[model samples]
Target chain A: MEALVASAVAVMTAVGVYLILRRQTFPVVLGMAMLSYAVNVFLFATGRLVVNMPPVLSDTATGYTDPLPQALVLTAIVISFAMTAVVVLLALGSFIASGNDGIDLGEDRE
Target chain B: MNHWIIAPVVLPALLAPLLVLLARNDLRAQRMLSGAGTVGFAVLAAVLLVQASAGGIGVYRLGDWPAPFGIVLVADRLATLMLALTAALALAVLVHVISTGWDARGRHFHALYQFQLMGLAGAFLTGDAFNLFVFFEVLLIASYGLMIHGGGRARLRAGVQYVVMNLAGSVLFLFALGTIYAVTGTLNMADLALKAAAVPAAEAGLLRVGGVLLLMVFAIKAALVPLQFWLPATYASAPGPVAALFAILTKVGVYAILRMVTLVFGAGSPAGDIAGALLLPAAGVTLMLGMIGVLGARDLGRMAAFAVIGSVGTLMLGVAIFTPAATGAALFYLIHSTLVAGAMFLVADLVRGQRGGLLLAPGPRMANHGMLAALFFVVAIGVAGMPPLPGFLGKLLILDAARSAPTAWAIWAAILVGSLLAVAGLARAGAAIFWATNDDASPVPSQPLALAGVAGLLVALAALTVAAGPVSGWLNATAEALYAPAPYIAAVLGGGAP
Candidate 1:
């Protein structure tokens, strides 16, 4: 299970980096979204991937999963969602103002 | 468990939402409320500084939960000093924005400004790493709104770049946090400090990786070389008051580096040494590159932006040395640079308003050319680390502290040469804007209150100079407290020593 999760994070991060390197705004935003997902999963896996265990502690349990990472991941998700929304709006504004979505400033490119 | 420790974070947090909900359409009311909140925040910061000066740590835990399990805000000498600086800067920037009517350019300016304060205060005070990340986002998103507040094409372009780059940095922040948590099983800094010393030899590699990644995140925020590409465009294009407020933002990065590196990973640790190794050379290069940028700049605004990057390098050079004397000097330099940088940005705006733009080419003399020239000259001398100003004293302290460093000569040469280059750049800009002759005869009218705001900052710098004896004493104690983190840990954990 740990191996699977690790490999998934690696693949997502690789794809995200590739897309982020592209010159267009849309691709870069998508790339950020992908990278954020990868980060979220990686944060979640920090608790070491326990299965069939409750996050809560009680008097009569064999063991329980660490609940802190779950909480951390949830917070990260909301923050990333807000971040993505803002970036999209910024990209749209830039596109409307300059009529191009390339990452470089128009004059600086030349 | 003193509750006032949380006031800096809570006051602004509550006021921001109230401004948005209650005074959304009423600019005058919004201003009154924000002004009141900022004044109250300043008072609270003063009280905190006084309390901290008496020498004890104040830790406030949420919901009566114990240290390692709950959210906590720690107020020590360092946090209080930063809080005081932020409040003072916010008040100055507020007056400038109100006087110049910069807030009227957009909706929700007051709300966003207050939110930005909340974020900065929280980032400074929070004891948990995850909470720090949350506040980082708060400050950053508000900054995005503030950066493009006036909404020009140039601003929008710069805002996009700033947003994208910071988002990347945030992702890296999460990765670093994950690695640290995975290795240590805790995120509360005091708890981590205790655990760090006990980490198994086998897990040392992971800890070093996490530490390096964290340093990189901070370096990006501080705009260190190679990672600083976004700063010139962003700061140059941001509205003047917004840019002034942002002078504190990079310091947030430096503040985090000082706090985390000293407390959680101090000397004798591989992670600390590795971070130091990375910071020193990078800071030297950043200093040289920032000077080059300053010389190459064609506009007053961009030159000030590059100078900010240069000051960050100087601050980090002190941090990289990581000695008590050096950190103390860095703290002093930190305060001086933030105020001076804010003043420089405002001066840029003043020149823009008077001369119709900030471009370097000769034009008609400004209406208040003589007064503005004097102001510019004083501020330029302060920024270039000339005599009789706090800037010179701060730089001298840093240079004095660096003598014992292994690479003292290199650091000294970089800083001395950087100061000379900066003086030349500012001199050139001053000449271009003030002394050169042009055909146009009309002088731009100046606003009195905005001028007062700039003068207020200048007065603050002067105050710093006059009080250098007491202030340096305070900074030295703060550095002592930081280097001896056992008291901080004990205070947070409710146990030994403190």
Candidate 2:
């Protein structure tokens, strides 16, 4: 399970970096969204990939998973979601205004 | 728990929404509310400064929760000093935005400005790593709105690049935080300090990776070399007052480095001042490249942007030394650079207003050409680290502080050459804008009130220069407290060992 989760994160991050290096706004935005998802999953796995255990510590239970990562992941998800929305809107605005999806400023680009 | 510890953050958090909801359609009301809120904020920061200077760390725990368990807002000398600087810069930026009617060119300028302040203040005050990330996003999102305020095609395109670059940096930040948390099991900075200091040899590699990744994120923000590609375009295209306010943004990254190095990753930590080894060389290159860019820029706005990058490079050199005296000197330079950079941007904007654009070519003789030239001259001296300004004093202090470092000679050479390039750049731009003029066109009339904001910041810089002794004395104490994090940890965690 741990290997699977780690490989998933690695693959997503690789894909994200590749897409982000592209010059177009749509691909860049999509890359950021993909990266955020990979980070979210990686953050959740910081608790050591526990399953079927309570998040909170209790005397009755045999053990509990670390709950802090769960909370941290939740906040990270919301922020990344909001940030993705903003980037999408900005990408759309740039496209409509300039009539091109290229991200670079005009002077240096060939 | 002094309530004032949270007031800097709370004041803007409350006022921003009020401006958005109540003063949405009322520009005058937005102006009045934002102006008044900022004034109140300045007063609050001053009060916090006094409270902090009394020589004990103040920790305000949310919901009465204990440290390492819940969020805490810390008011230490370093945090409070940053708060004061933010308040002063915000006030000056507000004056410029309102007096020049720059806010009227866009929707929700006032609300966004307040949100930006809230984010900056919160970022300075928070004691947890994850909370810092949240505040970073807050400030970054607000800055995106402000960046394209008076949107043009170029500005919007620049904004997209800026946003995308920072998003990548943010992802890196999260990954670093996750790695650190997975190893240390704590995100509270003070607790992280304790855990990091004692991490077993087996886990040290992961911790070091996390630390280096974190440093890279900060390096991106600080505009250090190889990661500085986003700054010039974004700053040049951002609205004048917004660009001026952004003078504090790079300092935020520097502040985080100082905090992390001294408090969490000091000599005892397994990572052991990870930024220390990397910052010095990167800073030297960053300085030279930035100054070269300044010399090569074709417009006043882009020139000022490069100057900002160069100043950050110099500031990071001071941080890389990690000695208490060097840290104190870095603080001095931090204040000087923030004020002077803001002044440069403002001067650029004023020149643009009179000359019809920021381009360097001669045009109409502007009204009060002599006065504008004088303002630019002082800013030029400050940027170039020439005598008689606080910039020179700040650089002298840093050089003096680096006397014992192994790479002192290289650092000095970088700064001196960088200063020369900056001076040449500013001199050429000044001559082209103010001295080289077309006599055929009538002199453009610039509002005297617009000069008020620029003059106010210059006055502040003058005041900083005059009060250098007392100010450095205070920063020395701040640096002392930073290097000795035991008191800070005790204050937050209520005096207990891990």
User: How does each model score on TM-score?
Assistant: 0.98, 0.98
Clashes of each: 0, 0
Off by over 4 Å in 2: A108-110, B442-444, B495-498
What CAPRI class is candidate 1? medium
Restricting to chain A, the TM-score for each candidate equals: 0.94, 0.92
lDDT of 1: 0.90
Predicted candidate 2, C-alpha RMSD? 1.8
DockQ of each: 0.65, 0.69
Question: What number of backbone clashes does candidate 1 have, counting pairs of residues 3 or more apart or in separate chains?
Answer: 0
> How many angstroms is residue B107 displaced in model 2 relative to the true structure, after the best TM-score fit?
0.6
- Model 1 residue runs over 4 Å out of place are A106-110, B270-272, B495-498
